[model samples]
Target chain A: MPERRSQRSIGGLTRRQVLGAALGAAALGAVGFRPRTAGAAQPPIRIGFCVPLTGPYGSEAQDQVRCAQLAVREFNASGGLNGRKAELLVRDSKLSPDEAATRTLELIENEHVDFVAGSLSASVQLAVNNITKQHRILYNSISQSDAINEPKDFSRYTFHEALNPTMTTDAVGRYAFPRFGKRVVFLLPDYAYGHEMTRGFKRVGKEFGIEVLSEIRHPLGTTDFSVFFPRIRALKPDVLVCCNFGRDQQITLKQATDFGLKRAMKIVYPILLYTARLAVGPRAYQGVVGGTSYYWGLEKTVPAAKQFNDRYRAAYGGRVPSDYGAFGYAGVRTILASVRQAGSVETDAVIRRMEALHYDFYKGPEYYRACDHQAVQSVLIVESKPAPADNQFDVFKILEVYGPNRVHLRSCRELGYS
Target chain B: MAALTPELLALQLLVGLALGAIYVLLAFGLSLIFGMLTVVNFAHGAFYMLGAYVAFAVAGLTGNFWLCLACAPVVLGLIGYGVERFLVSPLYGRGIDYPLLLTFGLSYVLVEAVRIIFGKQGYPFDSPAALAGSVEILGNYFPLYRLFVVAATGTIVLALWLFVEWTNFGLIIRAGARDPEILRVLGIDVGRVWRLVFALGTAIAAMAGVLAAPLQGVTPEMGDSMLIESFVVTVVGGMGSLGGAVLAGLLVGLVVSLTSVVAPELAKLSIYALMAAVLLIRPQGLFGRAGLLG
Candidate 1:
């Protein structure tokens, strides 16, 4: 009995504990609820997409996915990164922040993907930050939330390939100030993206001797633009700047046009140039000027862009893919650069390689902001052309290109990167 | 403050009307279902989303908008009927908790199923060639599609109102709600009426969805906001009162419009705020009866 008692204990683990475990196990009879993991050596190049694939911003995700796939295909065709054919194991965040974290785990554990790509919505980007950070895997955010760059939340393994609101604001101000001039009233989305946009525009506007009379914020997913419309119409500012995203952009613009604000005042913003064209169609948005990083029909002097656009239009039923498509494709290029330099599918090495990246794939100056991993690319200041002849995706006339320096980008190091 | 110039006010009104039309349709079915079932139907908006997706998928297959519209309600109604008989029927004698939980779970399941099946990406559904652009209305150019939606919704409300008053099935459904045990004792099969009520409610939601397809980008989450608003309308319009529902639907629409005209940010929010305000004044709601609560 004494010897049997001693047999029950084994170092830190008790035989009593083991016996307890064994009995408990016997009653339960092995639940067999083991979780699966992405196995052995062939670690897939996992790319996390935290976009609004199902929610209000779903259309944006659809366009983004197209760009991402195109970029990977292009990279693979060109012998991939370090001569290993690149693969993008995609996962959708469905636009909810909580869901973004939950879905990302599926990729991280099940597929054991190397890195994550941020989806279109900024809200989703905010959610994916720490979850991806804990894993120490790279999460490249295409979502335009500045929170990703702020000190409290910034991740070393994270990078942003899309425009921050500040970058967008500055680029638009640079392109529009000299031509359109800037006595502006900013109508922004009522969330963090709105704050970022309004601040960025105001900052750039001040630098360019422009005056902003008022900046108003509206809640996201507002179907009616009436309240803000009446106020903006009253302001009659020189540039009636709209800083909303996705369907909000469409609804706001359409309501603005209906309220005769377009006739009452001039209007400009990044989304006005792209999404508006689709929502209200070309007729309503015709002659509306705005700024964006890229346009489908910018007629790029750069051979790379030209080739990409041509191929993209061909594959996508001849309808032009928007700048959303370009950003997605460009994201692929950025990822390839990192993968090539890292010379492996390892996440840490890929992130290090991303930090050193400065690729020139455009006719104009473009650079990724080292501070926030934001791409400092050219913004096209465009005008809507005249008549039925130029009406087919010919919605905008090129006013100017705000190059990398014109926007005056800051990198992660400038943001006190360690 | 922006001055309310004639052009500005007129434009705001036009925009308000365009927005209000959609709100009316969203609230309509929820109101209709509440008028029949004492139990609130939370699954109405999910049906709305399903309708849009079905329309989109059907349109993708046949490239016909009319066919998609015609078929969506049938498919969704059948689905709604299935839920009523299986999940909702067992809980009929129980308290509201059972049906509420059941419908709420159903909403999540349906949303996730769509995500899993469609992979959460937006599928491109072409706008109807007929309703592509705007026409000059009320001294402003409004999208022709928006006008069509408003008109079609108006027609649907009127038809439903007429049918409920005149049709035998509608009368029997109304009678059952008044005395469900009597309905069962009379050998009228109250369960069948409950199932039919659910199917019809889902059909109405889908009707709104099909109409909305060309106007807004079809998305999986589209039905959610509508669902909340409809519940508000259902409560405010006095449960089981069809006429009250119509009034509440129009009221919500006007409230949304008026609020939007002055403050767009508060447009979607004003309905709930209005509901809260009304609930404070009259615990039963603006048109709801104390008798309906038991």
Candidate 2:
């Protein structure tokens, strides 16, 4: 063994004592330190997007996917949620409820997504809602299913980012009944969305003393509507309320023109999609009055909306985003805002912030109510005028913008929110 | 509810016939292929869908609807020939199930391939300007395009009937379908006849597709309902009977149209109901030969 070294001392403290003091201070520093402290690096917060990506609505789903991506890109470009970059996980729902639920769970359990958004059909949304409620993942639906926010379907973790059928009827019916006359015929798709629209229209019709001449429910993917036209024409209703969209709307409108139904009655789609108008051509939609939840023209009137539209069009091959796109962008943006406001990615904290938040998306100002998670936004009542000579997409001229006070359903407390 | 006036009834009848016209075209192809090849050709609807897409492309590029009508069938006929030679011909010696399974798989592949290429979004194809607008018929305003559909389909049907009943090659095809071995022993190349029959059947389906594209809008899934509906039409009319296909197509169309006025929900189910009723009454179908595929 080597000779033992003498103990060193400083300021009347032994060497061992000094070392013990230093090590104690390091222990204190390690125990007290936090990785999620302010201004520190953070892991990415992920959002799961479950939407129809292979069926008839696949093209519309692209709008949601692109806009959702755009929102994340913009948020990350602006330093993300408190300096933590926002990440998006997109899964194809295949327009199947089973697939939507499976993909949603995969996103939540496997991908560990903090939130989920996107759906066009009611069935898919309901399926996703069940899974999200069970898992307690925050789900913001862009679908306009009326039952989604009702007491029977209510969930604390779910919020609707788009307008419901009730609001659509109140807005479109209130506008059309007086101007277009009260005798109406409904050509609706035979499904929940169509049924909800029919119910809403009937309610508003009853309120306005409008007579429903007839209600014809056609199969969802009907390629022909001539069989129903003879009945519609025989009744000679003042207005034909078309509660259909996508290819159905396009096909029916084209055939309506063929059958000369336009000559005797005014044609209207209670809710018109931008793709439908474009697909059918402006000539088919000219002089038609309808309701749209969002339009790119609103960007010209609203500064914040204009900014978002400008950036979106620039990134998406100069293609203007539809209301569906606006809803998707709004969903992601609102979720991110909630995350930032709460200063944490915890579901409850974000829910609290989202409930109280008011923000402008690619439309006017909007907010989510605390009780039902219904976003209070303006409904666009529009007329499809001949597109101006300078612009190709300027098919609609906004007639009026109905605020949430004018169009929204009763408060969540009254609606029996869970 | 108002009374059903004579004009209304007449108009509804005409509309039913117009719709039936398309069914006739679709069912005719299905009947011919089954009659001649004994192959179900489940991909018949997929070929129809491809024809519509071809028409859409040709019309878009050429800005001529007539060109699409002319070219789509020809293009589909060539594709049919290739399909029969490479994919369907080898399974000829095997049981009917083999070709049926092959066609079913081919249908899935075609539909998915279409989805990959053109996407699920529907492409807009406008009716020709000449066919646009309505014309007064029997004191009722009817779509001129619908009248064209009826006329065109009628002409095609007549031509098909003539070919089957009048032509020497048609006799060979009919004989081959009835007894391929007899035709083979008679020194008539039944294989060549089979290929021709398959091409003709696909061509007819394609023709229907081109005609219906503007009305229905081209979609990858458009072929799905068409296939099922055609099957219903085939079974009711009697599989392998071209004339029976026409009769059954019209009957089904009339049933659906008339039922819609009374109860719209029964329109689709009515077809199945009719099929079941007919099958229960005559298992071989109204026109299908006895002891044949039911």
Candidate 3:
């Protein structure tokens, strides 16, 4: 028979007694432990990125994520926020406002992110802003929308990194009206973005003695533009201002080219995306002129642009960053810089820091206007190259550059900020 | 609004015909599959999208649009035959819902697989150089490529009519559709006829996709909206009726074009309104026989 073994004792105490003593010491140590201070072993700061990772804008959204990733990498390489590295938590907005809200709530409530940024659709960004506003989280909107800058959608935490439709229209109208006649017809997608673009064009048109021939509003994502071609041709306008985005823009441009509408009127898209141009190919987009937030061609003049393009190309398989993608880079870069400048991720501190920041990150001089938190930045008027160039990224030729100024922006009083 | 002149009206009618041609190509395929197999193919659109991608690949390799056009239908037809034989044929004895559900799942799988193989970004497919420019018609400029589409659709319609109405194989197809058990008793392989019908349907859809590639760039989701619209076309034309599909396609296109002239926002909604109207008046559809579904 095996002998019965008693519990081993240590230091003249029974095993249970020693274990209880050790547990008590551990409890005491746990109670005494405190989190490390800033600059110590702190957790990485999280920025919840909400964008349309699916739907028609999937490619553009992927590019945005790539640009944001580059921004995060640069931030961490430069010792992000006092040695606390920055991290991105990405969630698909799905290009739907309701989906964006749900995903954003998950990001804040479950993931516990410090800030939120992203959105390609104007309406979708507004949805995200509403959620971020209620939660008191700083949100840098990277999509173009004039409605978001109005008092109805404005908040202390809201900062628009992209140029609003008003700014884009002003730049395009001022440049194109003098070059391509003042008689214009507007083919706009029926949405907040389209309506805002029309408002801006009409406002700018008044200054150029523009005769508004007709304004054709089609449903968003209209694949067949054949029905509207007859009407547009009947109007016979000198300039056709197409205010559509993503797939809508691509289809409209291609169909319009097929119908030979480009032969009659000079087509001017308010915001011509680099991705859209690539999707439509040289033949469809050839000779089309529009305003862009950023173009790789700007690297020829701006040192910062050159640096950004070089870094982006080196990291992303030699493909230049797109215009919408550049907004992602600028938004994340500026927000992270604000966090560093404030020395904290506190909402109020970051807001204050962002408000005072005069940044020349990827593009030329840019600053957030105090009234509406809209970024005042340069708008590049670019014309699509008529033929395929040696460098594929050389899709556009910079016709003119409108420098950063409030001249194109609505006044503080107009924004109901007085 | 621009004044609607006689010339403008004529031009709009031509445009409607061109638009209807695409809808007919898509709807006929759906109608054929439903008529022969009684399977509501939710993957019809996916097949269409696959056709466009295949065409894009073929064109890239050979740099010939005509060759790609010929290759897309053959490739899609083979794929359809395999799918029908392996995936769909086994579920014939089961309720129709089984095949319907299976096809619905298959659609998503195909779209995702395409996305994986070809990046999410769309690729441009320019029209052939011969059809690149617009021709002046009725005192207005109209796309020559669109005219070609109309002519091609008319030819397909006539060919399909002759094949279905006059050919011995077509008589067997009709006989099998009416009573497959009777046809089986006569030593005919009804299953083979159904598989061929399914393959033919998918091939037609793929052909439509090849034609549409230039009008809209090739993308994974290109067939999604087209599929939904074509379903409405199939139902309004009388499900399983080729003649009905052609008529309904044109009618829907006309309604959309006319509504767009008055209220552009209602263009898309107009087609659904037409479907609802048709369903309310004649539930079996314009050309459908009553008690067919019952």
DockQ of 1: 0.25
By TM-score, rank the candidates, best first. 2, 3, 1
What does candidate 3's lDDT look like per residue over A216-308, in tens digits? Answer: 898776778989988888888999999998888888888888788888899998988788888677777888999999998898889999999
Question: Of models 1 and 2, which has the larger DockQ?
Answer: 2
Error of 1 at B94 (Å): 4.3
Q: List model 2 lDDT by residue over A1-418, tens digit each.
A: 0000101111122223323322332243235421232454775787888777665665567677667877877877787766787766667787788999987887787767799988778778999999999999999999888888887777889999989888888889888888888899998988888898889888888878998888888987788998888888888799999998667887888788778788889887778778677767876677778888898988777897788888777766577778777888888989998888898899999999899988876777789877788888888988887677888888888999997667758666667754
Q: Tell me how each candidate scores on DockQ against the true complex.
A: 0.25, 0.29, 0.35
Classified by CAPRI criteria, candidate 2 counts as acceptable
DockQ of 3: 0.35
lDDT tens per residue, model 1, A11-39: 11222332232233223322422222223
Question: What's the CA error at residue B54 for candidate 1, in Å?
Answer: 5.1
How accurate is chain B of model 3, given as a TM-score from 0 to 1? 0.98
TM-score of chain B of each: 0.91, 0.97, 0.98
Q: Stretches of candidate 3 above 4 Å error?
A: A1-40, A387-389
What do the candidate models score in CA lDDT, each in turn? Answer: 0.67, 0.81, 0.85
Summing lDDT over every window of 10 consecutive residues in candidate 3 chain A, give the lowest-scoring window.
Answer: A1-10
